[model samples]
Target: MDTRFLESFLTVAESGSMAEAARRLGITPAAVAQRIRALEDEVGTLLLSRAGRTVRPTEAGSAILARGRNILRDVRDLQALAGRGSIAGEIRLGAISTALTGLLPTILARLLAAAPMLDLYVVPGTSVELYRQVTEGDIDAAIVVKPQFAFPKTLDWHVLRSEPLIVLAPERIADRDPHSLLRSEPFIRYDRNHWGGRLADSYLRRVGIRPHERLELDALEAIAVMVSKGLGVSLLPDWAPPWPAGLSVAKIALPANAPERHIGLVWSRASSRIRLIQALQTVASQVSMDPIAG
Candidate 1:
């Protein structure tokens, strides 16, 4: 397929008019029309159907549009690979909330220091959303964690080893009788939909350690605050940011059946940025040294 023709077709799809597409491409409307005609002739299909002053895609046009975006993405990747420019481009990364505290600093601090001219964009969300962004090529890379994490053949996921979940409580809080205290007070619940939350929930279920669900909270700091106030008991990753003042560690035995979750960095081959991917891998390797933290 002609690269020029694909470019023109995409421009038309974006502009929804041959004249507009030609204007954006800095070419005559006739030239743009010729490129589309050339593309349609090669494909042996009617790609677009006219609708008054506007244009709409035929069934074939919609299918070709999808492929065209992918083709453009590949072209961009190739150009980057061939370029000799410094690592000065924008790198967009999405991370789970708490993961950013340690993991991102380990990775991005180096990147920013190495490439002072680079523009860094960091978006924090749940792990599941980060996975979607990577798959869509919307972000360059992401850090994902969960027990059932598996890579599709088309995508890639690198494990950073398992991070054990630990219970954080007050200094004198009931460590062995967490359930007893929970029944007496409110039990702070982490967001069950998140990776940490779900993993903690799984452990609770496996051990049959049920607490009265008083509060459903997500943020680690917030949970620590509630726990410090003697509101409840909570389970969290042993490897976490600093706890609030007065908060203490509450050790919970790993259930015989429940196991620690493996933390990983996942990226889509379709969207992986070489520098961003490398930075993430380097950080993961460094963090793997800590046995308690994920």
Candidate 2:
């Protein structure tokens, strides 16, 4: 069977729109339709049904979908094992911007060196967006903050790092208490929209400190820069190293009970790219333990 046809069919099934699948595969909608027709003809049954602008698999298509995925996975596994463990395929990975800046470089270098034939496609997004992409099968894996609530049963998470929430205060501030400083000084808030930011917010609420709000921003380095200039104090994670340079700010630890931000890799358990994800896990393990990440 033609794997290209199976892949096209799978992409369309996942996306629910021929146009969207075509965009993902970098092919025309007409070409996608032609391939699906060819596949259906080869199978001798209607594999899909058109519903307005979207498409859905028929009973036969549904029956074969799992089999088709297995076939694809087996083929790639055979190639990888037979070729001295050289993984050769395109993998789309999504990551939060913080991971892109702070952690992904070392992991990417190691992964590319191990599998030179692999084509890596990186998509930068927030944790929420990356989680959606992983769930929808748009990306094989993602590096993001672990959700506070229960995650879907279909996914697996591997914790890479746990960073404590910290207070960033200007050197001029004499106050040592995180809560007191927050209540007294102008606050450069970490944007509450992010998962990490939510951690900070929850901690603030628990500590009963309503900060004197001055600004709400997302970028960690930018927040560090702002605090360094004596703009305001902000609560943020003391994430791994390569921090913003020459920042004259004091990093104050929160009370022992404050929640730490957990960062890790997340992926669908049924994905065929298990080997690749394992490779990523290996690299992340090394990076997390490395002094540079601290």
lDDT winner? 2
Q: Kindly report which residue stretches of model 1 are placed more than 4 angstroms away from their true locations once superposed.
A: 1-79, 82-88, 115-118, 147-149, 178-185, 245-258, 287-294
lDDT of 2 by residue, 1-294 (tens): 788899899888878999988987888999999999999999999899988887999999999988887676576656545544556766678888778877899889988888788767677788988999899777789999987788889999998888899889998874578878999889999888899999899988987889999999988889999999998999998887778789899988877776889989999898777777777788888887877775
Score candidate 1 by lDDT: 0.71
Report the C-alpha lDDT of model 1 over 4-87, residue by residue, as the tens digit: 898788879767999988876778999999999999999999888899999888889998887887886676566546543656
In model 1, the clashing pairs are none
Choose the strongest candidate by TM-score: 2
> How does each model score on TM-score?
0.64, 0.72
Worst 10 residues of 1 by lDDT: 249-258
